[model samples]
Target: MRGQFPRVFVLPTKLSPVELDRIEGSVAELTWDAAEAQVFVGKISRRERALFELRRLKVLTTETSQPMRDHRSGIPLVKGAKTSTRRNGTDGPHQYQDTDSAGHDEFQPLRPGHIQVVRLQWLEDSLDAGAVLSTSNYLLYEGIKVENDPQPALAPTQVSQASTDDIAHETSNRPPESSQYSAPSQRLRQGSRERRTSSGGRSIAPQRPVLVHETTSEHDLPLPPIPAFLHTTYSCQRPTPVTTPNAGFVEELKKVRELRLLEGDSIGVRAYSTSIATLAAYPHVLQSSFEVSRLPGCGLKIAELYQHWREHGSLAEAVEGSKNERLAVLKLFYDIWGVGDTTAREFYNKGWRDLDDIVEFNWGHLSRVQQIGVKFYDDFKLKIPRSEVEEIGSVILGHAQAIDGGFQMVIVGGYRRGKAQSGDVDVVLSHPDETKTLRFVEKIVRALEKSEHITHTLTLSVRNSERGQTALPWKGEGRHGSGFDTLDKALVVWKDPEHAKSPHRRVDIIITPWKTAGCAVLGWSGGTTFQRDLRRYCKAEKGLKFDSSGIRSRSDGSWMDVETDPELGPAPDMVTAEKRVFQALDLPYRPPEERCTG
Candidate 1:
């Protein structure tokens, strides 16, 4: 049996040389035994004892090599017994007692020489190896082993004839007591009496005792189970709902399905139009919404819509409000050059709801460019296809190179990312020699304008005086007003006469000098809010000022000297320069496609 049981050896920590030597000696001296053995040096915490007991019990019961069974009946021992017993004077129950011996009376108390109970304890400061050996020996004697044990015996009284009524009455009528044996003893006594009366004096075999073993020290006895009613009294109660007075009308309507989609529903369209109106009328509201939950045009209904979009996967409504003919015509008119909501609304109020009305009215309000925009309104709204963008790029590049041998041009907006179509073409013009940047921009625009490609132009000159101040809107300032000096370049929007006005197509050309090329590229290649965020990060975190020209130091009022060399400069252009800036600030560079807040 010892040989059948596997050996288990454990070490709590790395063994020193001396400890290793001792282990070697112990192993060399261990002799082959039929039963299994394990050697461990670790301290076992109290929590591990129960698990160890279960493992040991399983091994002993199921893995023994010997086929030894009950000596009297030659049957295997029963497992998982609910009942077992030992006479008061009998040897304390052996760990692995057999169970098939009926009509046997071999069980007897510990005789003068048959049994021994030895107790020993180690001194508090003891370090003697001999004391450890003694403890091990005593443990070995008490340890359960199946090979050397005797069969288990039954009790002296059976309860087979006890009526169900009598058993129930006996259990219910019993009083709680501190005595260890009182309850079982009373039950057994009642059962015995009832059996005798029911059987009419015939002698019967005694029943098994319901044995229970508990290992607590005398200082720790088991407590009784608590009554069910006592537990219920201490449990937590459910919370009551509280009423709120300020909940909005839409919220108060339990069955309301407030629509909130970007492009489809009537309510969503109104909400979106309201948002756009709010942004145009009160741009400050955009910044305010980031901090507080309340703002003009941002009522509970809209807030609820934004919150729902952020949390749930779907919106309840879409943004194309009831399709009014006037609204559609106004939307179409707003797409033209030099026109805005105010002008569109003015036209609507005057009964000029369509393009034909504006043409027929023949007003002084329509400028030459606006007239062209109205003429080609449909085509201008359509995105410029990739092939057209390339063709336009070739035209601009050829014209630019022809003006100066040193000139270079790059397509820098969404088109640069290889998009299928573009809203407008953004070209970055530069030269290797920084001194010629001003001349380069002037000559390219001149050359393009001479080709009859220029239809309209808005030129802004950079205000060097306002370089140190921030551009954020201040109190009392109008929404569209940014009180900063303008740049010295022209923003030319033109119609391609070849791509005529039945669907009038237009191109926007932004020309900036080489000195502010990087900043200009970043500014124009915008999903507007993204560029704003990048600028904010530069100002707040890096203590650097960013604008169309370049990044500069805020503390000492010095410019960042970014050389124009292909390999050594901050970057070849603005896109790479922005990546470098973000990397320097330890932020991931967000790609253009993901820039849309929607």
Candidate 2:
């Protein structure tokens, strides 16, 4: 015989059709006598065996019933009996647990070797065999041996106990299912442990990590114990302390908490925290929490506020804690046109805390626009609802579409992003002919102003071409031109109605020609920082400049202007243009909604 005995491998489940064919091919290539052509099958788990039995009956009745004979008797098989003999040297029956609570008496053999082939195919179809073969968990065969004499099978009682023990062991040892199964956090912990072991016999001091805890009442709650792995001794220099304004800093924390609650889980909470951290003078303020929980930088006391917000809308004992006074001061300082946080802080330290104080003592520091900002501080703070934004967009769209037959206008911003409420409206206008957009902006602004809807106007100009260019000296020219060839002329309008006492509602309008529609749409439909990073990526890595106009190469030192003439060929529309840019740079064109980045 080419091989004296047949080797059987256990599988987790039944095989697919493709896998069954592969197993049959391998078996045909092997040379063995009819008596020696024995094949044994094993089940890896009880659940797998149950599933296999269910599929085997279906396959036997549908495909071939003749193959359902018992190997030893050559008769149709019955369950609960040892139908096939073991390899010559084997001493007992293959002891396997009953998969279901019911006995295996219902299970009928479909074929003598069919189950073996099915089991083998199941393993081949489901798993990457190469990956499994390389793993420590997989089984490998070195060789096989057989004896002429066979031994007696095991008793039924002995088989039952062995199967029960296997069940208990598997339940205890199997890993739990988790969201991060592909990129398990345990891998990081393993790496850190490995590093500590390699560093030799030096004792390291543990650093104090911040812990946050939620409060039951007004008083602070105790923090949870640090994880054991974090207690590892390692010496690293402490980071430099950050400076924070002593005046009304606590109140600002409360406002941040309020904003967090109002925004809820959907808004980018981490981004908001990072923005605050970067702006705050004291770095520890970033760590401060209103609740007692495991906030990254905050500890027990601050974690209380976070918990309060989660459970209730307002902080219990902290309602009157400098919040009103601080808001008044902030509102006053924010109105000064040129004055931001840095300038406002200086004024606050000088005892100028209110609008009257700022007007009297800090008039020289304030710009004309800041004076206007101070004048309408209360009105500006009110949020514009989605309904109002829609009304305003419709009004603008009506006027734009009336002027030109080819013009198309789309309302973007938070409304387009599917938010329930919006702060302001952003409308983008484009037309088929590039030349038609030249004087369209001015005409649209005049039309809206005449309707009595536009009460006031601010910052009306085409976005300058030189806005996002790198300042590099040219190799062989008088001067290197800007990266952006076209600029989007934007108009900011203020809508005032007789019903509302407020001065006007803010609306941002952008108009782009057909040639630059793709870049303009992407730039305008932004969460701000996302578009900035995209431009940065194109310039720094791709040696290409991208803006509201089009993409251009630094090497050519020339504009790769998109042909906008529809008569000539296909004009660069949003989808086609973006695809072209991405293809040229060898990067994927991401959808507008997924443009958010770090």
Candidate 3:
């Protein structure tokens, strides 16, 4: 394979320094001088983008009218062939042809002052096939070189968003050369349940249909109007349905985000969070990088990733991150019920690679809660089905009712937000009488513990009741900090005696006064990002303090009556009370299913 490649310049755009080094190291004639290169290799997918990169690099060139062709067959390299159909000469009539470069006659020499821009995948496939593969399907541009006036280096910036604002389109302007690539007849292959990329270790889900309408221009898919609420900075103000067209991509991004958290990259975690939320709200299946770049938080880097995913059926970085040895160990510890990312790293630093390591070496040093987590590590990892979550909620309600018949409960958490399964069960319990709600969590826990339904109690707090059951004062984070909710609550482990084989599940019981029951449900129902934004919206827009306990004036400590109606009087039920909270806050009411902002 030595000296088989021509003078090549690996464009640094969209590639990390390490990745650039890896690609450059493999090329026999890697050149830093753009003028001396015969081929420009990059991850770029479009001819326009290739030209933009050349201009950014200050390489002057004019488009060539004659297309590049194969040397042996003298056939013009076709455009618009899908990458999936480009396997080595077996899959179809137009399957990729491998160009063996054992001698000089196998390859056409570059014409004087001419250059071809090819996809980075061309090099990878050539190396894999042990020959220089024909670049017909991978070629993005061909041009004649010219001298440019020397100018100061330009700051690297992507194409202007204004020019790239189109919603979705194919990679090229030319019509497909084969029927398989035609827009109208092309169908999404529902291949295997999961397919691993040729690179290995990368598992991708089934392909989704490219959402577009058949038209003559091909690049003119009408843009769906951006939802009005998407313009708002706060995710709490918008509706986020659980099911989205870009869910597979979002899931891959989440894995990367989790890796960032484990690695303690706070900025990266927040950046990925914003991008994931934006994609989760997107309604259309993406067809182009331009569509992704136009999204609120997604820019060129994310757009490039979308292009890569479309071509390879998976994100390369995400696959590698999932296989990282350090991250895998960190995730094992992070998944423990009582351990967080910080604690996970702490365990890793202590040479604890798995649960057995912690139990064998550091069992005596482990906290009681963490020890319990280690004991039931596998059991806690199991997801609780919706039916079992409901049954657990019923058992808690039944025990609460045993203490007092007036107790009311509403299942919250992921169950309320339309998840098929949940990691835990959360329920808000209230009584019509505020007096009964005071110190009520203790009674409910005691009753459940007596019945053997409650196995372990992680925490119990009654801060709100002890402080007269009022909303906590609105102080800046510097003063009050992001403390736990002031409401009375109990975190416990539960199991069903009827199903002896049932896995132990985590359950939370929240006690709220009747006046603030709505606040309790609203606070616990939405996703983590949705709740964080709700507090932010209150402080920045509404000038109030929000928590599960209640809402209060920021300037003063007086509790705000968001659950009461001015004309109709107090809310008659909890659901109405929640709606009244939305009304009082001047926010449009969002149903539980629409609060899945994650």
Candidate 4:
């Protein structure tokens, strides 16, 4: 065993289908700017050795059905138990008093229905053996000998626990029927929702299907034999307009989108987005799942969902999510800025009931941006009228011109795309001088605040793309990665100075070099799915990286020439570069107004 595992190894972990799918996409399948995640299982000793040496890889025991025991007391925690917090070093109401081998209390109370995360204490490869150990109250999973176990059986297994007749009622292992599914669902949420892309403030609401580059024909319903042209995979090929053909049906799909997003399945979210866009643009009412399957984006899964919609009138996942307390709380909490579904789950685990609860006890742990978000959640939820956005835009533009006469700003997002009401305003600014753009966010924000219009600044990030200039790189660092390529960005809470106590609105001020300003305008002017597909198209087909800042040839890692002059004068013209990006990628030039991927 020692030789086989190098005296230290990670066990062959049990994984879910979704987990496998997430880890499955690697260099060949994944996009350029996605987080690194993958999983494979086989001979335990062999596989663990390969991964353990990587140092950064995290090892976790897939959640088991019954509650597991603590290493110290060998006593199992109740189903869904929470950790006891101490005030002034005194135990809270639900404290676990289990004692250790030395007759001292020691436990890292395992909550029921959640997987136990184990930390390795020493170099040892016996993780897959049996009977977990405890150091500082850690509970280890004692692996069973799987000699030649089939792969399928290794999926989340039902852990066995001794009869809890002797256990106290408050700390029993028996769980409700709902708890059984809760574990996997929470795991899925945990695995997926941590690093999700925000899907709002993109373009006009109720987006229609995409107007493809060269396609002449449009989707005509109530006819036999669907045209081959109507079934192209690309969203750009189809004419998706703002008129929602199937609003009720699309609403159901939105729930799926919500679940996928909450689970952190960005790819899945994208998959649904394509289908949603196609269906939204569909000119005719979808009468059946068979009809849905015939559409451009729908495949087996989407077809099944359509079938469910026809027969049951709703999705099973939607029904389940509506009932899951945890999911509901997570959905509500996820609205806060800088707070993802993962952070929401952590808050739930801490017994945080509402925003006030979080504020009362957990204010310090939250990022400064998130605190601002919490303070103005209700105000941010209120939509901004086109007139209001225009006023805000004019104010920002006027402020910029005051600071620098040549600075120009355009409202992108929903307002630029002609939405009646928008969740937030996304304004893209540009200046001829790259130096001026460097600290443009700071100056503009200062100017806006002076007008008493910019109420609060949520986040300010300036690009210090000079390699090795910033602190340790975050996960999934790439030109088009998690945060996306940009010059400088400021997320702020805003309200009109005239309406002093009026509802606050979310505003994103994006400062870009004149060279890549067009792309920035194009990327930020979104119907969420439209931007997603744009990135997908650029990456998969062209092997070029496309972000707001500029396009980079994936081959050479050098930026495409969107700039006219490298000298410190006015930045390169984006009008030329915008058209050039389309030409270079061999795609039809789509004007900002036509780009909507909601």
| lDDT tens per residue, model 2, 431-524 | 7776667757777888888887776566566443233322222232234445443454543547555567654555778877666666666666
Rank order (by TM-score, best first): 3, 4, 2, 1
Give the per-residue Cα lDDT of candidate 4 at 28: 21
**Model 3 TM-score (2 dp):** 0.64
- lDDT by residue (1-598, candidate 3, tens digit) is 4226766777654455446535533443454445456888876665656766676455678789976555555566554533233332211223233343333232346789988887777777676566665566566688888765444433344344212521132234323332111221121111123323222323333233233222344347666776666656577788889998988888887876776677554445655676787788787888677777667656544666677777777777578766766668878999998899878877876667788899899989988788888888888899999998998888888888888898888999999999999998999999888889888888889989888888899899888778767556656544652334778999888887677998888888999988899999999999887887787778766778798878877777567878877788766778888888888888999999988877
Better of 1 and 2 by lDDT: 2
The ten-residue window of minimal lDDT in model 2 covers: 232-241
Q: Residue by residue across 1-598, what tens digits does model 4's lDDT show?
A: 1112111122212333443332222112111111111221221221122222121122233434544455455566443356542222111222222332343232222343222223222111123232222322333332222223233322222111211221132133333322221222122212222221122111111111121121123233354555443454455544555556687778898887887666544545655676687776677776555566556456444656666666687876677667755567767888887788668756765677689998999999888888988988888778899998998898888888888887877788888667789989888888876667776788888888887888888788776333311222222333343335645888988887786678988999998877677677767775776675676667656776677767777665666654444554333455555666566567677665555556
lDDT of 4: 0.54
Assess every candidate by TM-score: 0.42, 0.44, 0.64, 0.60
Runs of candidate 1 exceeding 4 Å displacement:
1-322, 360-362, 367-369, 455-488, 493-504, 539-545, 551-575, 583-586, 591-598
Instruction: Indicate whether candidate 1 or candidate 4 has the larger TM-score.
Output: 4
| Residue 499 displacement (Å), model 2 | 3.9
Q: Which regions in candidate 3 have their CA more than 4 angstroms from the true location?
A: 1-218, 480-484
Clashes of 3: 0
lDDT of 2: 0.42
Model 4 lDDT-worst window of ten: 200-209
- RMSD to the true structure for each prediction, in A, is 33.5, 24.2, 19.3, 16.9
